[model samples]
Target: MSGISSASGILAARSALLAAAKAALDGQTDIDFYSGWQYPVTQPNWVATTDVHADMDPANIGPRRSQDETITLGVSIGAWLPGHTEDDIVAAFERAFSILNTIQTHIRTEDITLADTVLWCVPGATDSDGAVDEDGSGYQVEIATTFVCQHRVRAA
Candidate 1:
């Protein structure tokens, strides 16, 4: 947590994870990965929202003074095209799968474990107007995932 979000510290974890998510989402290597991603500084909406604290107490496992704490890092991807089809949806998922794999690799490299990481995808329209088109055929695939990560205290 030293860097916490600095360009060179552990705090930049969210940035790191965001990069990994994009890379994992796109099945292509970034020619200029650094410039390709513009990781916004850790916003109060993103960082402090989660409880990140750790301690070294062997007995803190069985039970704690407070309730069990948890945090979730949610990732989402979406697209909208006039003529999207089923194949497009499949491709979107395939891309997401690739990105998720790379994400796991990056996490392991940093010695962090992903807990309860789940992927959910669906297709829908973006029109805020609730009116069914008489003759409109299009598709959109959106992927939003939540990676529940926790600072493990003990094996128990």
Candidate 2:
């Protein structure tokens, strides 16, 4: 049981995921990994992990001895370029998608179970959307996906 509640298990899963991401992105100086929120993003290329939602229900109808849970965690990829030209936008797009691909491949092969903290983990389809600043600050591209982690929580 490992004294793992649904909430605690979710936390453990996120931590493990962050660690795995760090390991996967290490030595790639161009990519920066953040565990949570980042304000006024400074890097041209960066990835962030955030909490999305969670679902939990009793594993059995009787006595609430255990529960099955799913926790959704988000990964956000951002690419920015100072120039606002069409070529700059294309470059940003390529960089953002390349980062997304690296992340997807790492998630697929590296830590599907989040270091045994969960039964299994899988990233959902990515949602891509972004905006360009009217003031010409930079060209920005963002891609986001969620990793759903399933686990069983036992009574403490």
Q: Name the weakest run of 10 consecutive residues (lDDT summed) in model 1.
A: 43-52
Q: Show the colliding residue pairs in model 2.
A: none
What's the lDDT of the predicted structure labeled candidate 1?
A: 0.35
lDDT of 2: 0.76
Stretches > 4 Å off in candidate 1:
2-13, 22-69, 79-82, 109-138, 152-156
The lDDT for every candidate, in the order shown, is 0.35, 0.76
| lDDT tens readout by residue for model 1, 1-156 | 311111222123334445554444354432113312234422111111122222234444454332222334444433323334657556544544444445556555533532112111111121111211235453433344444443332222
What's the lDDT for residue 145 in model 1? 48
Expressed as tens digits, the lDDT of each residue in 57-120 for candidate 2 is 6544236567777788888888888787888888888888887776667867987777788877
Which 10 consecutive positions of candidate 2 have the poorest summed lDDT?
1-10
